[model samples]
Target chain A: MPRTSRAVKLAALPDGLPGPEHFSVVDVPVPVPADGEVLVRNRYFQVFPSLRTLIGGGVKGTPFPPLRPGDTLFGAAVGEVVAAPGVAGLRPGDLVRHWLGWREHAVMPAGQCAPLDGTLPDPAAHLGQAGVAYTALARDARVRPGDTVFVSGGGGGVGSLAGQIARLLGADRVVGSTGSPDKAARLVSELGYDAAVVRGGRPIAEQLAEAAPGGIDVLVDNVGGEQLQAAITAARPGARFVLVGTLAGQLAPDRSGTTAPVEIDTFQLIAKRIEMRGFGGLDDAGPRPEWTERVGAWLRSGDLTFPHVRVAGIEHAPRALQELIGGRHLGAVIVEL
Target chain B: MPRTSRAVKLAALPDGLPGPEHFSVVDVPVPVPADGEVLVRNRYFQVFPSLRTLIGGGVKGTPFPPLRPGDTLFGAAVGEVVAAPGVAGLRPGDLVRHWLGWREHAVMPAGQCAPLDGTLPDPAAHLGQAGVAYTALARDARVRPGDTVFVSGGGGGVGSLAGQIARLLGADRVVGSTGSPDKAARLVSELGYDAAVVRGGRPIAEQLAEAAPGGIDVLVDNVGGEQLQAAITAARPGARFVLVGTLAGQLAPDRSGTTAPVEIDTFQLIAKRIEMRGFGGLDDAGPRPEWTERVGAWLRSGDLTFPHVRVAGIEHAPRALQELIGGRHLGAVIVEL
Candidate 1:
């Protein structure tokens, strides 16, 4: 067994869209599993935009551990447990996903590590399709059957999965918005969107009108800005908006101390009777083991697709995250450690 | 019975906030009841901010009928049914409330008018505390026991009642925001609010933080601009914001072609997991007859108070409405015809 494990750590607090200079990977002694713990060799780690909060600053009151210099990055990662001394129901070679990422190893409590289903061919696929998108569509937005759905940032991690989830929840039509025409076309052709519109080409309100002429019944807003206003304008009466991200500011060249203003018209809000809700990640989405299994079965059957940009090694993880933030990548960005 | 009834008519569509010059009272022959209809002698009519929507312009797709010049203005009013013809369960001298208001007489189907209990001394009180505030609190916001509630524009009709209603619903604390210092003091002293903060003097966010140091669990936002931002900042995780009005723009000297921007921060929305819902009045609130009766009982018992500006005569109705639009009147504005 290798005595050393390489882990990614914050080099410095970020000033803007993060770069490789903000992170460092160092060799360290692999953590030894104490009582009731298992040593995990992390195979793959996920990256997304919201990690900036943990990396750059801290929320006043949140359960998420704030990232600091020399501290290993934290996120969802899939790994194989190499050692589980005296821990029942857990054994060596068992593939598990846990809340520790951007590292070669993790020593987690045995019961805390959820066993990953080996149904899908690629183990990394287990890391990308977490519960947030499904929870937003089914629980938060309540994307009912025969509903017309619109998703902003439809090519991003949550948006990509949310469109398919909306369909699986019985949405009649799924329309998406993307930043580039190429991504717009890809959203429809590859991501199961019935139609897609480019964000910048025309006013989103104008373009959304043509895409969903009857107006959207459910909106999964991953990019908030003018897009949020356009969604409010195009929303059918009693439409539900599940806001998951603000990638508009995430794409900025420098967003040091500035905040993204999500403007909505009060008249339209009242007239449309819109319901807007925001949700955090898996923790906020209560444990839905049956629902998760159903989703897993669909994935295994090729009914649902998990789209992601895969990087070859841990060294490329920070750059991949930077590129993902800059809108250079599509869908979930993950590194195979 | 008088053969002719004097009614307030819109002389012109509002150029700005509206004035007496834009309205005229005309005498017209009272129509005789036909079929199952009754001729109502409207004793009092209520005028508030949202009535401007029906009076000034049109909402493309809504049940609310548009107002035009030479037409009697429409709103909630309480009146004694003079003649019910052959209609059963309704009789003359029975006080009832209906949607047709700002008039001295109304011809309506007997079944359409809801009976007003004589328990509360002022029948005009029923015209003001309609089902919107009740519905917004109970169903939309789901304000629960021991929750901290915050209300913006707490001096206005819905806002005034919402603060008291929050307490009755078992809220641990109820805080309110108003435009003036006097209204702020009156919110706690007269309106059953636990605490009140004036909007303009100190930053609302700062005052709100002091008022609700633990943060607010529910927000009934009647004023939308800066107050909305303050409420969002002071919101607790899983807070629900029930949006009932946009009176911030209603106080504007001239809002001819402008729209009120409701600004929200996406990060706070996600981190806090806030749910925001907007509702129209009365019809959208659905019929809550039993709850209305309960609220009426509360008023009669001195537990809930209905505060309103009472205009003595129909001739002053237009001026009263103008004052309401200008934010000069507190609670409801009702005119005794």
Candidate 2:
């Protein structure tokens, strides 16, 4: 008898805030694994802001494919293999992480799955601090000793990890910025941030100037609007600004009270002798096992900590994703399947 | 007996476009060379757009001191040594290049100057193509084999040499954008640009898309504003945009008939994974003798070419600087004192 599986499917493309109406939970037959394939029973999956770009219309000028209506939402998931067909290393009980997710069961090529080493306290840790965020900060930004590091949107998924990773990488001072005063306090008190700039209370540039004083050596930007503008203004000569997200989006209210495109003064990049590069960790098919091992070590040694908000069951995945896009939740937002 | 030398002095910091009133010709007695110092009879000195920044209140932040009134405006000049005071590597009648110009003669420590190897036909070449432009393109930008390069302001000083350097670095196809149609034609006809985009004729983004349909892999940005915005739009995944200038200034007329701050979409930088870095070349005090040697070898082999607009005599220096700021001249602008 064939097993049955349930999955969350995209009902329609999103236009800003994605509601429950844009997703549907549907039942389907579990896929039969071919030779060199594994069947995974997912335990947890992630929902982050980058999903907003994918579900809306996809990233322009890149090959990021948009999901059509009725297509299963694919994402990183930690799961246990239920069936393995002619797979040498993977067994039915083997724990693994794969990109075929947002579903109860995923049948994919064995090579696409990475078998977890069972060192993590929970498999879901693969989706949080021990994954993309760590690699993005440690490798791409290369935060070093004596460097003044700043992470914008410090309460968010990547920002939280980035702040901690900068500390582990030996940053002299790690500063973060968040939209809420509570998150701002959390960054300094709980997270590794030496200081946090709270948005909406003051112009970000003034806050950052007060915080850094000397100037920012490295800025890992997650919020792009005024914060990014502020980062540019506060950047020191030969500073490095990593472009991570546009949480502030592209448009802003102009002086006439209408939305106009927000701009970056390119002159600053030249005048200040800054280097700004965009980073998309693990998306480009680079080496990840080394990064994964290092982060795992950090976690095991208790040097790294992560907080995640969870929504139980696959049906709540859409709501969880909405909460993430709305910036209503701090830290990583994951769904238990 | 002391020799009398006439030099151009900054009369006052200019409010905007510098006029003849902002400069004055002053006579001074040339100082005798001290031990380890060399006196040079100047041949040519460069007057490019960056001077406008120094004379106009200096660069914001980072300790760029403003030129005080009556101070002789100093810059790079190539000349023959007239007096050497027991300098190990220096002697009278030896050609050398030093950062002491805007006058008929300069006296400085021999260590502050580099003796020219007498490879080029004329010493003025050291102030133009054989100097900062070569280093900025080859070392800073690292133009590589088969790269599709786009140069903004390709008719002007650095842009002209940058395009040629890209070609010599094994770029498959090079595209350039300039203000005038004549310059656009010249980029393709006289310079090594494979194609050209004429600004103001069409939206720069549209023109760039049509010119490099495959997308630009490397962008040497000299004119910032709309050109930088367009380069960001036209960039391929993992493209590198070298921030060389901000000739577009700050505010530009938007489509809504209002002056808007020039902006770049940080989201696009993330999506495209583009790396944008500012280039300062020889200004930062680094070892350049190796670079000068390689570039000199290239120039000697007839692989490199440069054009310059000369303003004769010290009195004409201010007008030449004005012409460069006005974008009236092509290639390097030099003062023949």
Candidate 3:
């Protein structure tokens, strides 16, 4: 058993996108599992979009509290149980998915650490698809069969996997909007999206009109500024827009209500009978078993692609998160602990 | 009956809010009713908010086509059937409601005119309520009993009656937002609104926080600019916001997308899970009979108050509409011919 472990603690709250200076990776004595708990050696942790909101404080509507200085950051992690006491169904060498990430090891109640049967070869793959993506598109937005789905920030963590999940959920056509031209190209070419609209090139409404001529039925929106407004304009009557994130606020130069305000023409809003909702799946405690089983089958059979950029070592998790925020990486950024 | 009647036609599409110069009243010979048709002497017509959009051009998502330069305006009008031929329920002097207003007389298909039983005193009362407000709050938002409701454009037509309707529909408390302080005070005192927030006096979000303190459960929004944004900010999680109008857009100085845009902080949107849908009740063909019966009962029993501003003649309707658009009057604006 390892005698010591490491954890990434919130060194400081950042004014903008966080970097290594904002996080302090420190050595600590490893915690052992108590009664009904299991000691997990975390194999891989995800550097997702919510991390940007997490380090700044916390997102509203989510149950997770903000990390104070010296507090270990929390997120999704796939790990192997090294020790268990009085825990049923969980044993040593069993792969599990749980919160308490940003740490080399986590001591969690067996109930919180959901076991992953050997359906997929990579433990990191378990961190990618099961819960957040499923909840946003299938459960929340209810992406109907033959529905046209539009996802903003298609290169980011949840958004990257969301397009694929939407398609698997029976979306007839998927169009993604990305700030990066390369990411836009890759989204259409590799991620099974029918088309991709690059932001900053032209008016998104003009582009989306050409991309999805029938108008988008469902929108899994990650960036929520001009993109959201454009999506609203291009949405068909009775369309469902699932607001997954607000990168526009994060990427804003000013917080004075002057930057990138999504000006929705209310006349259009009522006329179309559009429905929009916010998602807080990342803060959820458990993954849906049905999603894991379904997604795993798809991944293993080569029907789905989970393009991930995996970084080595827990010490680099903070940097991985920064890269994810900067839109440097396309798809999920997995940090191997 | 007069051998000739006066009808108002669109003179020219106004660049902004239309005035007397934008309309021309022309004399036309009254036509006899054909088979299965009724000749109605128009008693009253509504000079409501939709008239603003109608005069500018038809609203999107509604079936109502735009009025050309010479086309006579169409709207909700309550009239007395002077002649009926080969029609069931045949009677002269029977009060009925139908489209084809802005004229002294109309020859409508017998099926088009819905008869209104003498549930209330005035024939014009039928024109005031029974459709738009009921559909917006009760049907669209589904304002539950014990729910706190917030309404924008409280002094305007639909908004003025909507508060009373929401309260009658079992809303625990009703709060309204208006630009005029006098209107706000009247909304609380004369109308059924529990509290009234004056826009342009304080930040709407701060006022709403004080008004509904518990957070708004339902929002029947008419003016969709800063007030809508404020309502979104102050909304309780899982609140339902019904989009009723875009008076802000109507009142904006420029149509270049630079004015009065509702900057929705989408982070707050998802966190609150606020659900909003558009209301197209005004453009609908018929008044719901159930609403008329229920509202008539409410009005007669003194359980509901239908506040209205009346103009004497149809010739002055164009001016009444201008006054209504300029916020010179409160509640429903009715033009008696």
Candidate 4:
């Protein structure tokens, strides 16, 4: 007998804030595995800010297709395989994490699903948040020990993991900027950040000066515009300013009131010889079999830890997304069916 | 009998535009060279825009001491050595070039002066404009063959030589921006620029699009502000934007009738992987003895030609500066005494 599954589908495009009306739950037949494919019954789904951007008409200059009405909201998920289609190594009843959608059941190519090592405390750790964030922070930032790393929006899913990863990588000092004082405290006490500052209340430069005192060496900026400018001003000579988001605003405001476009003094760069870079998540890059092996080892060895996940049902994914958009949540918001 | 020399000395700090009142010419007894010092009779002095910025108190956070009232006005210059203080390989009546000052005579350490080979058409070529500009263009910009190079302020001293050096480096296409159509015509016809666009008239992106068609790979910018923004917009992925000057105004005006601080989009950097670097002439870190040797070789071999220079007497130094400040001259303005 074929199994039935509940899935979250994009009901409509969101304007400013995503609501329950923007998503709808529907029942669908579990997909059957085709050649070189595996059948997975998803247990956990990942919700993130990029999803918000995606639902709002997608990122500019993106070459991929955009999410449309009635389409199942796509994301990476953790599931258990009931059957495999002509694939070796992967067997029935294996817990796996794969890139699929919000559906309770998914049929993906065998290459997409990686067998979750039983050694991990929770298989969902590999699927939703910890996996992508850790891989991105490690590979893209090239985090190292004795380096001073600053994470903007530190309370968010990626920022929280990035801070932890920085600490695990031997960062001598880890500073974070969050939207609230509670988030700031959590970032410090719970996430191993050396210091945390509340954003928007005070001048970021002044706050950073109090936090780091000796200028930041590596700034992982997810909040752009004014925050980015403050970070730039607070950066030490030869610092690296990495842009990961522009949540604050697209353009930096002119404080001097000259009505002129911001003219970055190239001399700052000349004097300090700083390098600025940007990075997106690693989902686009094909599965790094070694990443799984290594992160799995780290997870098993207790060298890395996963953040507390807020789980919701598939029907409540829209509420979870709304919470993420409102910046009310501190960790990964995962939806389960 | 004591020898007499004329020197221009800084009088007082001016509020904005420096004038003849800010400088005083006085006669002094030329002193004999001490051990490790060489006495040179000055020939040519270079008037640069950086001097203007310095005089206007525009640069901030610089390590060097600011100009003091009644201090000698020093800059890059060329002269003939009349006395060598116990120095080997240098003799009286030998023409040399050193960053001395705007004076009729100067006594610098023997280690500072480099003996100029007489093969050049004019010894003033080393002192006037060729050295700093060519060294900056060759070593800093790293101009290579087949690169599409864009030069701003092509009618000025550094821009002219930068264009010539780009050509000498075998750049496949070279475009320049000038303040006037006459300069643009001169840049295209006489200076061998592939195309020249009038500055402040047309949008730089549109002009660059029409000129290069493909996109600019290397930008040697002398005029900053809006042109810098436009250059960033027109840059090809992985292109280099080199900031060498800020003549087009330092602050960019914004929409709210206020001046916006200059800030680059770190996202654009990630998407395009572009590198924006600043080249501040041959300072301490740049190729020094090797650069002098190589440029000297090029000059001696007649492979690099020097631009025409307008000469003024020592008393006319203030007027020459005025002319430069007013943008009245082309090529280099050299004060020969």
TM-score of each: 0.90, 0.89, 0.84, 0.74
Candidate 2 clashing pairs?
A263-B263
Candidate 1 lDDT at B225 equals 80
The runs of at least 3 residues in candidate 4 whose Cα sits more than 4 Å from the true structure, single-residue gaps closed, are A1-147, A161-172, A250-263, A280-303, A306-315, A331-337, B1-45, B59-100, B103-147, B154-158, B161-172, B250-264, B280-310, B314-322, B329-337
- Using DockQ, give the best candidate's number: 1
Over all chains combined, what TM-score does candidate 2 have?
0.89
Docking class of 3: acceptable
Global lDDT of model 3: 0.79
Candidate 2: Cα lDDT at B156: 80
Candidate 1 docking category?
medium
TM-score, A chain, model 4: 0.84
Predicted candidate 1 versus true structure: per-residue lDDT over A15-119, tens digit per residue: 886789999989889999998899999998888776775675654444455678888787789999999988988779999888789899899888778876555
Chain A TM-score vs. truth, each candidate? 0.90, 0.89, 0.89, 0.84
lDDT of 2 by residue, B1-337 (tens): 3479888899986656777889998888887889889999998898866566566555455345667787888888888899898998777889888888898889998888888766566678777444555566676667779888898888787888888888888888899988788888888988889999987788999999988988888888877878888888888888888877666651122221111136666767887888888875564244446555666677788787776788889889888877776677778888886
* lDDT by residue (tens digit), candidate 1, B1-337: 8889888899998877778999998998998999799889999888867667666574444334667887778888999899888898788999889988888889998777877755456787677464667778888888899999998888888888888888988899999998788878888899888889886588888999999999999988887888888888888888998888777776666674223566777777877889988874554223446456667778778888787878898889989988887778678888887
lDDT of 3 by residue, A231-332 (tens): 888888888888877776655433412123476767766667787777745433434455666777888888777788989999898898777767788888
lDDT of 3 by residue, B55-112 (tens): 5666544344666689888788999889998898869988888887899999989888
Whose TM-score is higher: candidate 1's or candidate 2's? 1
lDDT of 2 by residue, A89-124 (tens): 888888888887799999999888888775566688
True contacts kept of each: 0.66, 0.63, 0.66, 0.25
